[model samples]
Target: MSTSVALAAALAGFALGFSMIVAIGAQNTFVLRQGIRREHVLAVVAICALSDVVLISLSIAGTGFVLGALPWLMTVVRVAGALFLGGYGVLAARRALRREADALSVSGAEPDAASRRRSLLAAIGTCLAVTWLNPHVYLDIAIVGSLANSHGDARWLFGAGIAAASVLWFTTLGFGARMLAPVFARPLAWRILDALIAVLMLTLAVLVLLPLFTGSGS
Candidate 1:
């Protein structure tokens, strides 16, 4: 690709990746939790970025049409994702309410290191499932990738550029947030983060469910 096209592709990819992921959701929440605990950050980031790569690749390779052909599949995904989001939102809100005095200590938790390690791995697995199992990820990747391909760019190059953006953004988010672990060590800060997470999850659940009710009315 020419320098100008490559630059454009890279910028486009970065913008799309950032925009899609910057929202607060289960995946980002899990990543932030891992960051705070200072464990398995890279592994969690890898799962997220790699999942995006695979989904975006499938989207660019004409799988977008196949997904489009299965409207019921999308409906199934929408319902399942909504339920998951809502359930997670309730848990977050419950955490917000419990609001223990010592909830945010980074170094004081007494679990054995092995147990902590397993918890980190479990968190990573959950993040991967939340990102990969959601149907909207496929819709965004496939639609965006196919649109980029229509611009006559090399297909593999386009997908690679987009995938690179995913890798870069999630890695930064996972690691960069960990850099703030000191600040989050404060119980008050942890409370604020948990409250914020609760609101974000509930807001997203509302966004998901509003369409269903509205569409039914129309």
Candidate 2:
């Protein structure tokens, strides 16, 4: 491909990828919470971006065809993801209700090593689950990959652009959230945030399972 065509394809890919991921969802909400808490922010951002790269690459490699051949697999994933999201939503709701448990502290003192390690592990595990378990992610990859492939010889460049978009977006969201630390200092602010997360998560869980129940492959 000529240089102008390649650049255009890459820029198009970046725009599509950024638009797709900028929406508020389970993964974004979790990342926002981790960012605000200042707990494992880099790890969470890495997982989100890296997972996108892997998924996009696999889709470009024709994994979407394999997935299409096994429609039942998507059904299984949808059910599992809905259940997981529902459980998480309940937890967020509980946190919102219990002020003592949901307090957001901005103190400079850090947790001990053991506690920090455990928290880090938990955060990483949750981030992975949120990213991987969502059936919508595969659908997105298929869409993006199909679009990128339309660019002919510039497809790889397009995929690379998508990856770049993921990295840029997650980095901005994870680090920029700290700017709102002052606003989240109050315990009530934490409660409000948790409550919003709870609602969003539960709603997403319902949406994920809706197609299965309604018999519409929306």
**Top-TM-score candidate index:** 2
- C-alpha positional error of residue 44 in candidate 2 after TM-score superposition, expressed in Å: 0.7
Cα-based lDDT at residue 131, candidate 2: 97
Q: Return the clash pairs for model 1, or none.
A: none
Model 2 regions more than 4 Å off? none
Error of 1 at 126 (Å): 1.8
Could you tell me every candidate's TM-score relative to the true structure? 0.84, 0.96
Sliding window of 10 residues with minimal summed lDDT for model 1: 99-108
- Residue lDDT tens for model 1, 1-218: 78778777666766766787777667878787777767788888988888888887788777777777776666677777777777777876776677476344645558888897888777766786678656567678567767668757655666676788778778888888877877876777766777787787777767765766778411
Q: Which residue ranges in model 1 land beyond 4 Å of their true spot?
A: 1-11, 102-110, 216-218
The lDDT per prediction is 0.73, 0.89
lDDT of 1: 0.73
Per-residue accuracy of model 2 over 82-196 as CA lDDT, tens digit each:
9989999999999899948455675568789999899999999999989999989977867876888898889888998889999999999998988888888888999999899
| Residue-level error in angstroms, candidate 1, position 19 | 3.4
